[model samples]
Target: MSVPLTLAHLVWRMKHVHPGSEVVADGTRLRFADLADAIVRMAAGLHRRYGIRQGDRVAVLAFNTLEHLQLMYAVPLLGATLTSLNLRLDSAAMVARADRSRTDLLVVGQEALDHRSVGPAVRAAAAELAGHGITVAAAAELAADVETELPDLREDVTAFRFHTSGTTGPAKSYEVTHRDVVLHALSQSAADASGLRAGDRVLPLVPFCHVNGWGLPFVAALTGASLVLPGHDLTPARIAGMLNAERVTVAAAVPAVWFDVCRHLAELGTAPPAALREVLTGGSAVPRSVVDLVRDVLGAGVATAWGMTETLAVSTYERADPSVRAGRFVSLLEARIDGNSGSPGEQGTLQVRGPFVVGDRDGWFDTGDVASLDEEGRLAVHDRAKDLIKSGGEWIVSAQLEQHLCTHPSVSAAAVVARADPKWTERPVAVLVPRQGRLVDETELRAHVAERFPAFWVPDAFTCVERLPLTPVGKVDKRALRARHADGPVLSPDTPGGTR
Candidate 1:
């Protein structure tokens, strides 16, 4: 009953069983059978024209599009590892990642080359690779001719490698085998919290460069779901229109995208597309306010999942029960809280062991997140251990402070970072983004936190801005905030106002 679980198997099954299922992109759509044929042709082109050998590293710099999806499948079929470059990275970062991966071939999407910011990054990468004689081709040029057969591939071969967002430090490259990809797809498809099923239409607002859009493309193929890609059009209005036009049943993106979409819908005096049942969010903490807005205004349930590039997109997904606030580990993953003190609701570092999960040590992968396991076995993440601030020899959870700050009526976004202090080793500094047409007073914001949390847990300073800096994948750039404010004045509640 056991057979090799490679992407080739998934492609053949989808092509044969759901040939007519559609995949909608920017202005084009293709059936599963056609998509499979295109992937084959592209694989052949990469092998013959581009000199892509088995086990070679192929890097793709592009926005989410139909062609990008084809490359996602094609590179794996060629027995090569696909490295998706984050389009949001600057030119230097892109060049650094391409070089670090030792990429043998680079494929650039025409749309990305036309982009003002991404174009320069792609050109810089191309220029650097030229010296190495690595082939750089437009994605469109690789999709012709469909007369090639799938190469014999082993399930254990590394098929995908994605770099971290580089927010905390230098981005690290994580590798996943073909079997890892296949099992992750199956696990996601089987999770009821995923809200994915046959005949359903799914749109991934997340970029393909980020964990292959959290593995939606493969999940869609395996479950016979219609895949809808947004391409380079990430505007809230455009995304709302697509949700309505495509009748998307399941969608996934970061919390920021959902917040913008909800705001756009409200501005138009509209509700979520009636077809939308679940909106899956991850990549960062989901604010409770956003969750309430999705339920009350958008008429959809918000499902929060947790994972990273190392865990293969998803390690845990929220349970279906309304009372379960945290996610439960997927069936294939085993999770434990390291350094637990054997107390009720004790928090510790989360460690996971799974077939597809990667780590430097044995089978165990440290997630670098502080979490607590509830009586029901649901895992609630507290914060990143690095993001935790030590003040007066006490640990302060920045996520908790940010959550409280976001509850303020005028605060739309909040980030907390550690500032070196002469007295305490470090002190917490709060950065907040104000809601449109509203201004947040530092004194009042500090009071809001002081009332809710212990007096010592209150932030030492508060900075209000029009917006918070975000990383490539839309998570708050706490590192950038710390760098910007580390040398600035440390305000107190008595201070008139904080830095802008």
Candidate 2:
């Protein structure tokens, strides 16, 4: 007889091998053994109370709290699929995701329901969900003391329903099986990957709604790494305190969070926690400055990861010099540049194939990124295919230009968007956020870009702004930039045209 691979085995590991492992969230701490019991009880309660069965979809709208974490394991253990709705999304988008996933039950965290900005959206989603014959309940009311037997499930059973961050366009939904989750978690646990292990206190600053907190929760369960959920208070101060107070050895978040945390630590004159060993960041390109700050201020190695919702969080991790390359492919994954004929120097759309990856054609998933792969299998993503600016039939990579422009002393952030021009069909336009208490000039910025790039690659127009708009996931909102600056530059106080 063959033994099946399922999350049930992970729960078993929690009960037997790592019973004493801790899970801290919102000032409450629980051992793995206790969490396992709660998971089983919650699974039973969900089944008995809501009649949730195999193939049913349970949607959760909440922050990174203990209750939210419990539902991640509980809903799936009952052979039901867990659909995590992005609480940061607007009410319409949240409802659309729930409706698209065919949610049979909706669990709203009490904190979410009480939130000022998210409350209205949750109530709106809940009201609409109830109208569609879906059972809606508060997360606080779902826990049960009832003891019940868990069901055995196949590895191929759908365990999670995830949606893309929709940074470029509308959000798209996808499903991951038990096999995918287990394999991805195991792969991430490897020494070269996230290097998760027992005794490590892991804090996932990434939201659970975002690819299951970038799969850290499950990795913690599998490896016996104590999980420290950040809960709703994502302020950099709070995260910084938790790192030292909880003795976190491993942490993960997007580049934006790390940048703020670095500043916060500098403000407080605090050092990186002694126990902290590594920081995993991605979601968008990890700037070299952020990587250097992590190493210099946090005194930890930075794993600049690259992956998407379709690729199961992060597929590759570059640790040594993260800013230059995306990283070598992790175990159980493969990558190739589309249309590249065996030349590592060739650039094309990045396509990946892996056991856990979702692909549209054949088994290879087109990553929508224009990238080049070195002989060592390292990936250098140039820019998103849609974001590339074509001028006089020559493509100008926006990400490269943006990175170079940000290196300027007075610029804190930069985004390069394509502007329509009758002469060249399209020209590069730059939008920059000046560093605090600093002002930049269009002439100096133009000269800065012209130094490295060709004259044509230099942006035709430059605009200074107080801040760049961001997507729900914290990536620079280039789409919005294009729309806002399509015709001409929008002058701000810092803009050369306005009084500085």
Candidate 3:
């Protein structure tokens, strides 16, 4: 039960916990031994078929299904680094990462690309990718290989690469080691059984990106917890059905996924499937309204964990206490704020370090989020700290600008992107999706934001829209937002790079 330092030890632990029992359950199931055998054989195939030597990069682009998890364990079993593509990234970003990591081969799943409308740029890039070949494989193809001695991932070697999500420039690839995976799994393990435990059946909506999904899948394999994998699509109705059908005990995902699921549950004339026990949400903001509704209606445990692909696990939260039903405000992270190094309490950059933390320290990982620690000792992420605008030499948090704008009675949702501005370096621009049929004009929105936030913090222009673009992981796609409104006449930046 001391965290499986080596993946082989993790497998041994899995066999010890549930050996012949189902570790991954789709409509049917595969036992720990079944999974173990499959992973071993696949590792052999990777070596024999593609020359995937230990430490080579093998990329997988697919939804969260049993096969993805198989690849998750198998890649490392072969001592290769698994590079998970942000399925939402258009082909160009995807190709760039493939190039950066120098992926040896790409395995694409049918379900994953079924709905993708990747651009021509990505197509060209994928075609010219230097990898041996791009393989379009399926669950059926993987079931055949089941006999071989697979090499264990070198704990000291790079085990995977996490991409930057590329909301700004092209994505950057960062390596994660086998040691990182083991320690991360350890960190998620409850020091006193307060977090995860044996016999806990978990329903995970996060994709098998070797990031958010890292710890949960192993819960089933390493601790005899049942894993219900929801293949890619996270429709509210589908989520409700899975929660009810599987009687999932533990659930995790970004807030937006749950936001829709919660709405679906309301539509079905029921609260979150009564069988559900605890829910963990992150990857985006949890509005006070959403938190209030979950507490009042569902009555199930809901906790928020903050993490990044870079760190591999939860670094900090405004709230993570067991005693308090603090929806998402508990501070699991311990750190200090030193002036402009970060915001004071309620507004500063969040810098964190811990056993599970992943970062290229020169030492700290600048999360680019502007956050504040409330009097209750909870951390609230206001917005990306990088998204801040310096107007007249003072900081203007776009999140504050957006929050104020959204508060206007006629507004439904609002976002503030950095606009080009030569004088202030940058300024805020409001993009609003008005409440259905109700008209909230740009002038009204500007006046509304100005009255609430400081004048310097006010947005210089407005771009009305029906919805905000989202990154593959489901957070607001600010990169696209910047591109959409970057060239507005209201503010002109000195350089073209800042324009978008």
Candidate 4:
């Protein structure tokens, strides 16, 4: 007889087999057995107090905390779908996503309700959600003294409703079944994949709101990897300290967060935790500098991943060797480069299909990335197809240019965007943030790009800025950059207000 693949099995395995595994958050550490009890109690409370039942939706607006993690499992155990709201989004955007979820209850975390920057927005969103007849309550209210038995849940029932990062367009929502969560977790824990195991102390610096913390929470429960969740205070100094305090073995976050942590370590003349063995980074291309810093400073190997909210946030993983290649596909997932499905070294749009991967009506998901496949089927993403600049019929990959520019000694971060040009149709322009106490010279930047890339690929103009804007999920906000350079007198490096 075959068993259904659901979260129930994962919970059972964690409680029975890995009861000693702990989840650390904000100075609180709860072992697997204790966490299982919490989930049971929380499920009972939701059922008895809020009347949350099977097929209902419960949305959470909180950071990565013990309470948030409990709700992640408890709502699904109650046979209700769990929805997460992006904390970085504004009040209106948050309200829109909450409305779209048709949430029966909204649980606002105390930390979020108390945050200065995000508190107002959370309150605004809660007020609007409550006005819509959706029951809104504080996250602190999720507790009960009695433990209740979990109901039988089907494998195909929707467990999570996730929103896309909205990097290229408006954020979109997708559903993942219990089977999708379980199978993805099992695939990620494979030796050749994320390699999460029983002894590994995994740190997910990524927000729970982002692809369910890149699905690491479930992988931890399935593989017995202890989780070290970085709560709301994501300061660089705080994160570096946690890495040492927790003795983290496998840490995951976007490239920007890693960069901050590396900088913090460098400034303090400190070393990364000796147990930090691997750093899993994605969201955008992991720069070669970041990979080098992780190895030289953090004493950790870098695993560059390629995934999206649609693909469960880590479908491909590579050892990164300081290269931007997105590694080969993991088990259960398959990809093709446009029309060149099996051909090696062919470049085109990347499309994927798999049992756990979400797809359109045609059964294949177009990733909207211009990519190439190596002889071993390893994937290398060039750039977003829409972000590529076409000048004189030649394509200029903005991601490649930005990565190359970031390698310059004077540059800390860089972004390349397409500027409308009547003569060439579209021209590449560079926005740069200089290293501390350094200035970026446009001529030097041009020479740097022309040294490796073709002469025409060199950005036509360079604008020096203090920093590049980022999307809610922390990828470079190229849409904002393009809008800035869309109609302005192309601001020169010498412009007084260029930094803005």
Candidate 5:
């Protein structure tokens, strides 16, 4: 029973046991058997036509499509590492990432090639890559008619390389071995954090290019679940339609996507289908209102997870108890609060280590997040270390402020950033996005915060935006916001208070 832990093994298991399972994408449905065959053909085609070999880096620049899913297994089958390029990155950033990853071949999605908004940039990057001897081909052009046997791959061989979101700074690439992927998938499937099960229809609204769609594709293949790909139609309405049409049991996405879906459901006077049981929300903080909405409208429990690109998508899953705000770490993962001298209730930098985790120097990897363990050993992430605002030598967690602001009935979303201050050095500024057709009163918001927090914790100024800018991965783009308002006017106690 000592089988090698490779993605190829997972695919072979699915092909033999769950071959009849369906993977629906873009109104087309294909069985797991067909998918297995296609992957073999694609692997053979890539090797014979493109000369792809073991240890070569294959970069895939695409959206969430069937083709992208195929490459997720096919590239690894050839014993080559797959680097999924972020489609949302600008041309320069995209090219820089490709160069940094040392990609040998670039596979562009046909849809991305034909896209009016992003196609030109992809082509420009492709041309630059071509000049550097990096062969560029459309994913559709890489298929072959002949099947190829899977190459022998070691468990320790690097299977995939993912680039960080680069929200705070330059994006860093992290490699995950075949063993890492297999263990992560098995742990997630067994944990059943999102209530995934065999034959359950699963749809990942997050792109496969992002943390392997939070590892849902692999988890689906492992658990015999039907994988539902949304293709390029990620609109809230479209996603809702697919959820109903496919009777999806489990779904995952960032908080922003769920917000839009809730709005769409409200507009349509509809609720999620009866089959939908769980909605996993992450990528950013999940507002309490969102959790309440999903439970009330969709009748699905919302599970909030916390992880980074380096952690392989998720590390903690909220416990079943509603009173527990923190989540428990998955099996085989160990966590601690760095530099914490107090009891478990004290907050500090969160560090984790496990077989699948990266950046472990001395058996501990700093997560760059401030967290605390409750009496029940559940983790509560307060805020990112870089996002904390220091005023007069005191740290103010921005996530706490954002969460309180989102509780306001009229606010749809909120982001807090540190604004440079002449006296305080850094002051908290609140950015509010109002609910549709609702006007936000700065005086009312100030009063709301003034009641919950001390005078110092209240934001010095408030800015209302139609929509907060988000990073490519859908988290609030606080760095961009800080850069935009860093040199702007700062409000003080002596200044008159009004909405900007």
Candidate 6:
């Protein structure tokens, strides 16, 4: 049997199976049917009143909320693609993305009133679209009474356009089909198949702009699960309070958010929240310390995910081996191992090719990440194939540097990147966030690195930051770091120079 990609099937299933169940807690209660009805009505209204149609791209400029989640259902009702616009990106990037998607409409909510209206690029696109006659809707003014009927979309129609952070470079755009979205929704449902039962509350701290908000909305809608949208203010205290008060059983976040919230809970003399059953962390490697925090502090298990926007959502997950279960980790997705080009315990790139993995090579969609797969099938993401530092033409894993820092007593967090140099072509640099308000200088850090690594592999420079700038999705904003320090002094291969 083949799965047909359509919101209709999901809505019907939910309405029949658990219609009266609360599907979303967007600061208010709404049943799955209530939400589905609203989506159908809006999709109808937009199509009839404003001529919104399928195949056209609809950009949403709001944070994670009930209305934003509604768009996921409503847009596809009209056969239109949803482009979840990142709120943290500049107006310029937004416009560029919108233009790239040829966005025909943008739906924004009232909570966004404090923000300056459509970005200049959006304004320009709006002006251009208006010249050709297009409709842009503000939430307060939209009504579901319009009488327009929407057409059924083709099975393979594109449903969304996801954008990469361009953290390493300029962000690239990719289109996700209705099939991709549907498959992602189903895939994520499988991940939630463990301890979470129907109606279990799952708090989503991840932003909605990313890969269908990592496909959270779809999973909840289909599974008759409840969703708690935490808006844009992601303070650790706020999330911690929600977890405790709401008795949220499951949640998803990047390591950074997890770290901060865990810190807040610890400060309050609390653990990872007794109500929390499982925590899904991704957006980079799962530090050994983080794994320990999730296990010891929260008394919960951790599942690490791997993927990119192009994959629509997760392709790999960290799980424990069934037979051994001796605290050995494993990835559920299809994977293979390759050469490490480093040292012992340091393995090679974990190459993968699966239906969910997307990238173009000759014709394949390579994920561009170099990783390692243990005998147990656990995947440790080493570095971006493009970002790996090559010293004397031998690869120096930057992730290894970060892993070393995470284990250090004084370090709270670290990001290691390659600096372009004339001699080695590129060398490592360590940008860090210290733990417990510790003050760490360059000499002290270099000395620390020298103790663990060969002198040549030591970072040529160290930049201490109050906090690493994060992308909208909450990963360290390495792009911002390079923009600030790309012109910093270069170290000579002949001597160690970052001493002052």
Model 2, span 1-500: residue lDDT tens: 78877888888889999999999988789999999998888888898888888999999999989999989989888889998888788888888988744788999998888888778988888888788778888887887679677777888889998888778887788888989999888888888888889999999988898889889988888889999988777888998989999999999988878888887897788867889899998888877677777888899999888888888988998987787788988899988898879798689999998889964525888889999998888988899998999999998999999888878887766789998999999999888777657777778888899999999999887787776787777777877888898785557665353324
**lDDT on C-alpha atoms for all candidate structures:** 0.82, 0.86, 0.64, 0.86, 0.83, 0.68
- Residue pairs whose backbone atoms clash in candidate 1: none
Could you estimate the TM-score for every candidate? 0.94, 0.96, 0.80, 0.96, 0.95, 0.85
What would the per-residue lDDT of candidate 3 be over residues 261-352, giving only the tens digit for each residue?
A: 76566666785576777777766555444454455555666676666766775544333442122222212334443245443354567666
The C-alpha local distance difference test score for the whole of candidate 2 amounts to: 0.86
What's the CA RMSD for each of the models? 2.6, 1.9, 5.8, 1.9, 2.8, 5.0
How does model 3 score by TM-score? 0.80
Backbone clash total for model 2 is 0
Q: Write the per-residue lDDT of candidate 5 for residues 1-500, one digit (tens) a residue.
A: 57789998788867898898989988789999888888888999899998888898899888888889999988888989998888788888888878744788999998887787778888888888888888888888788998876678888888898888988888888888899998988878875454577779998888887889999999888888999988766788888888888998889898888888888898888966778888887888888777777877677888888888888988788846321355888777888898888487899999999988866635889989888998777888888999999998898999989999988988878899998878988999887777877767777899999899988999987877767899988988988888775556644434433243
lDDT of 1 at 159: 91
Candidate 4 achieves a global lDDT of 0.86
Better of 1 and 4 by TM-score: 4
Q: Model 1: number of clashes? A: 0
Error of 4 at 316 (Å): 0.8
Model 3, CA-based lDDT = 0.64
| Candidate 4 backbone clash number | 0
Q: In every candidate, how many clashes are there?
A: 0, 0, 15, 0, 0, 9
In angstroms, give how far residue 443 of model 1 lies from its true place.
3.7
